[model samples]
Target: MKLMLKYLKRYPKLILLNILGIFSFVAVQLGIPTVMAWMIDNGIGNSDIAYIKKMGGIMLIVCVLGGAGTILLTYASSRISTNMIRDIRNDVFIQSQNFSHTEYNKFGVSSMITRTTNDAFQLMLFSNMLFRTALLAPVMIFISVFMTIKTSVSLSLVIGGSFPFIVAGVIIIAKLTNPLSKKQQKGMDQLNRISRENLTGVRVIRAFRKSEYESERFAETNDNYASNSKKLFKIMSFTQPAFFFLLHLAMMAVFWISSLMIDKGTLQVGQLVAFLEYQFHAMFSIMLFSMVFVMYPRAQVSANRIQELLDEEPLVKTPTNGITAENKGVVEFDHVTFQYPDGELPVIKDVSFTANKGETVAFIGSTGSGKSTLINLIPRFYDVTSGSIKIDGVDTQNYDLKALRQKIGFIPQKAFLFKGTIEDNLRFGNPNATPEEINHAIEVAQAKEFIENKPKKLQEYISEGAKNVSGGQKQRISIARALVRKPEIYIFDDSFSALDYKTDATLRAALKKETKESIVFIVAQRISTIMNADKIIVLNEGEVVGMGTHKELLKSCNIYYEIADSQLTKEELER
Candidate 1:
């Protein structure tokens, strides 16, 4: 909540103007009752029609001024609240962009989405109510109190007596709803997570014939969310009726008591009427204030959630004096070890290797053997717990992140593409790449034949997540996108898994010629995919158990022999 004030401070002049508008509105409201009292006492009582006419005209002018002030108040309040929301949403999104994988895991994708869109919207609603109703409530109450006191002290006491009861009711309702509001927000996050999973895994669910199970899973969260919302709204429903009942009860007492005072000649009829009018306005303001109390608790919950994300310091911070790579296409891992932030054991341990220009280094191991994790280190996705990874003889951490990444072309295991034309997606790697460069990359990646078959070629639209393309096609285009950069270091993280053996062989053969000046690092599960590499690193339980060529490893390393025996025929192995 305190953080939100930072954005509000940006528009000081608007706030000042809104304050002026509120003052004018309150003055006109309070003045109207007073003018009516004057008309009754001096004009009607003395039988002077001119005085009555003059007071009526003054009353009309006051009403007009009040209407104008309301309009100004609406405009200024709306402008400030909306602009503040826009700025806050932009900051939150930019902040999310800086988050590392560690932070992403902590918050999860669905929770971050909820905070960015839904939570920010909740704050906007609260701000709107604050400007239009919350501020006016207190000001109107104070002015009404002062005016009523001047009219008749006895009637003012009636209005004042009702204040404590209303305050207590509001306090009780706020306490009850606060916990429910927080629970509601958490429930909403869970529901969103379930919905996201359902959408992304819809095919998996249908393939497994688990549609009923998925439906039950969604229903459970939806029911919990609905129940929490119902409880919160039920508690809030008490606020309006309770406050109105207390206020009207006081109003009836004011009229009852004022009648006796008038009959006794102690108070005039005009003053009694004016006091009742002021009492109505005073109680009305408190009712408005109760509305604020009802809404503030929920907004406070959302504010805390958004603030949490903004306050998180990114684990990976860009250095102010970061250096660039002095030498190109050389990568080294010296006794590198890494563990996830929450993991009990390291994923890669005491592993060391190097791949220089014009060399192809491959890694192969069973699942959970740290193959992907080792390559992830060269790009500094996660910093090593011990030892160092260097590019061009300089420690990766010391190099500017953007400068370091520019030298490496990385393809993840799952190929993701944005919703755009083929040209648009390819240009993401090198925005300044020319058509000739693009065609060359497409040819080398073995994607030219398929791409040219399309009616639009490079201009063809790719759906979100590249769903319009086959798995093999997506993999090839991903490789071409990386090729457009012609980076000094190429990392293929099980990137050939989707390609048939023949296509995989062809792509790797063409890559050798195209990347003569680059260092290629490949992570593969298939023995055939990496058997021809210049050097192969075999990982076993987070440790490199073998390091050599295919023949060297087969003779010297038993683990390599068993892997080769399982995949190749006896005749092939003998050869």
Candidate 2:
């Protein structure tokens, strides 16, 4: 909750203006009852028509002033609350962008989305209420109580006597609902996660004929959320009615007690009526304060959630004073080891290798041999747990992250494209890339032919995630996007798997010539894809078992020979 005060401080002028507006509103409201009391006693009781008319006009003017003040108060609250929420939402999103892969996995995508959207919205509602009603409630109560004391000290006791009970009830209700609110928030995250999974994997669910199972899973989460909400609302339902009952009881007591004083001629009729009005105002103000207790516990939960994300320290820290190297593409992994945070064993162990300019270094192994993990370390996606990774004679950790990443063009195992034109996607790598450069990259990736067939060519619309395109087409476009950068190093993590053998062969042939000045690292499952590389690395489990050219490895490495034997003919293997 303290985290929110920083944003609130941004609008000092608005806060002052809102306070003034609320003061006027409460003053006018409290003044009207006093005016009516005077009219009833001095005007009607004394048989003076001019006094009645004069007081009536003053009451009408006070009503108009109160209405205007209410409008100002509402405007100020709306502007301040909405702007604060917008700033907070932006800050949360920006912080999430800085999160490393480890932090991302820790929170999960669905939970982050819920925090950014639903949780922020909850804070907005609470802020609006705080500015509009909660702050005014206390001030109104104090003024109304003061007026009651001035009118008749005896009637003031009614308000003071009822205060303690209302305070105790609010405290108890808040404590009861606080834990339930946290549970409700967690349930919402689960519901969102399941819904996102179902939407993204709808085709898989249909293919497996498990829609009923998915429905049941969704229903279970939905029911849990519904149950928590019901309990919280049921508790909150007691608040308004209970407060109203207390107010009515106090009003009745005041009437009964004040009548005795009026008959004895100790308290005037006008003073008695004014005192009753003040008592009502004071009790109603307390009721408004109670409303805050109902909504605030839930919003406090949301604020804490947002604060947790902001406070999270990323596992991979960016250097404050980082360096860069000007050397041509040269990558080295020296005694590298990596283990997942929750895994029992290291995924890659004591691995050492290097790839230099104009070289095509390839890695091949059985699935889960740390092929993708090895490449990921080069860009500092997950820093090596043990050893150092260097680029152009400088350790990767020493280089500024942006400068280091700009030197490499990496294509992940899965290709993703934003919803935009082909040209927009290509420009993502290098915004200043010329048309000629984009065309050259498209041709090298073997995508120019298909792109030309489209009526809009480079301007054609691509759907979100590039779902409208085939896997092979998306892969080619991803490759082209990377190429547009003309980076010093190119990494393809099984990027050719979706392409047909002929297209893969042609793309590789074109890349050989196109990337002659740059270093390239390829992770592939197919033996043919990597057989003709400058050097080949063979990994088994987490260890590298072989390192040599195809022929050299076949002669010296048993694992390489077995892998080759399964994928190549005897004559092909000998060649």
Candidate 3:
């Protein structure tokens, strides 16, 4: 809630205007009861028709002015509240984006989504209602009290005694709802996580024939969410009728007590009638106050969640006096080791390697062998656990990330394409890349034929993630995207997996000529892909088992010999 209030300060002027509107609105609303009191006491009770008509007209005019105030302020406050939400939403996104890999993993994907959407929405709801009802309620309540006391001391007792009941009601309901609202937010995150998993892995679930199991998992989370919601509502249900019944009872008490005085000739008929109207105003004010309190608990839970994300500082940071640029195409890892944020064991350990300018270094290992992790270290995607990785003799930690990453081209195993044309996706690599530059990149990636054959060529529209294209085509586009920049170091992390043996052979052959000036690093499982490379590294169990040429390793390390023998014939492997 404190964080939310800080964001509200951005629209200080608008908020001040809104407060003024609420003040005027409450003044007019309070005036109505006063006019009614005057009409009933001085005009109707005395049987003065002219006074009654005049008071009625004044009351009607105040009601109209109050209505106008309500509408104008509602529109303005909504704009302020909505714009505030937009700012918060943008800030959360920027904060999350700035978080390091370590910090991001701590929150997880689904919880982050919940914070950005559900939590921000809760704050929006609270602020929107607070501007409209919060200010007016207390002011009207105070005014009603003062007006009743002026009418008479006995009538003030009629209204003020009921204050304790509504106050106690609000406090009790707020306490019960605070915990339930927190639980509700957690349950929502779990439900969102379940749904996201089901959508993304729908094929896997069906393939494994585990639909029933997944359905049960979803049902368990869904039921928990529904049950929690019902429980909170049950608690919340106490406040409203409890408020109405208590407040109306106070009004009835005013009527009851004032009636006796009227019969005794101590109070006039119009005075009793006026007292009844002020009693209703007092009750309505408390009802409005109770409504705002109800939203507070839910908003507080939301605010805390958002604050956690915003306050997280990225683990990776630029040094205070860090240099921005470095020599390109030379990478060295000295005793590098790494582990995922939550992993029990190290993924890569004590790995030492170097790839100099115009050299090709290939990492060949089985699945879970840390081949991709080794490549990821060069670009500083995940900071190394213990050792230093340097580019051009400068420690990676000392170089600004923007300058460090610009010299490297990275393509992940799973390709990602944004919503745009083939040209636009490629141009993402180099925004100022020319049309001829685009075609040359496509040719280098071996995607020229297919792209040229497209109905709209580079103008061919693509949906999000490029679902409109085939798997192999998406892979080529990703390659073309990376190739357009012609970075000093080109990292292909199992990039040739999707292409057939023939296409993979041709692509690698073309890359040799095109990438002569670039230091190429390839992580592949296929023996033929890295067989002719300048060097080959074999990783197993987080350690470098062997580092040598293909033939050199086949004649040396047993692990390398066994891997080569299993994939290729012993006669061919030995040769």
Q: Pick the candidate with the highest lDDT.
A: 2
User: Considering only N, C-alpha and C atoms within 3 Å, which residue pairs clash in candidate 2?
Assistant: none
Global lDDT of each model? 0.89, 0.92, 0.85
- Clashing residue pairs, backbone N/CA/C < 3 A, model 1: none
CA RMSD for every model? 2.0, 1.8, 2.3
Instruction: Give the Cα error of residue 102 in candidate 3, in Å.
Output: 2.8
Decide which is better by lDDT, 2 or 3.
2
Off by over 4 Å in 1: 40-49, 265-270
Candidate 2 residues lying further than 4 Å off, grouped into runs, are: 47-49
Query: Over the stretch 1-575, how does candidate 2's per-residue lDDT look in tens digits?
Result: 69779899999999988998899899898999899999998999998999999999999999999999998899999999999989989999988877878888999899999999999999999999999889999999999999998888888888899999999999999999999999999999999999999998999999999999999999999999999999999999999899999989998989898999889988888888778778888898898888888799999999999999989987776788887656757888899999987778999999998898999999999998989998998888888889999898888998988888889999889988889999999999999999999999999999999999999999999997687899999999999999999999999999999999999999999999989999999999998899889999999898999999999999999988999999899999878
TM-scores for the candidates: 0.95, 0.96, 0.94
Error of 2 at 15 (Å): 1.7
Question: Model 1: per-residue lDDT, tens digit, 1-575?
Answer: 69679999999998987888898898898889899999998998899999999999999999999999988898889998889889988998988887878999999888898988888888988898898888998999998999888888888888888888888888888888889989999988998999999889999999999999989999999999999999998888877787778877887898789889989988887887788778888999898888888888999999999999999998776677898657666788999999899999998999988888999999998899999988888887778899999888888889898888888899999988889999898998999999999999999889999999999999999998788899998889999999999999999999999999999999999999998899999999898999999999999999999999999999988998999999999987888
lDDT of 3 by residue, 226-337 (tens): 9999999888887778877887777777778887887888887656666666667778888888988987899889989998888888877666777776665688889999
After the best TM-score superposition of candidate 3, give how far the Cα of residue 10 lies from its true spot, in angstroms.
Answer: 1.2
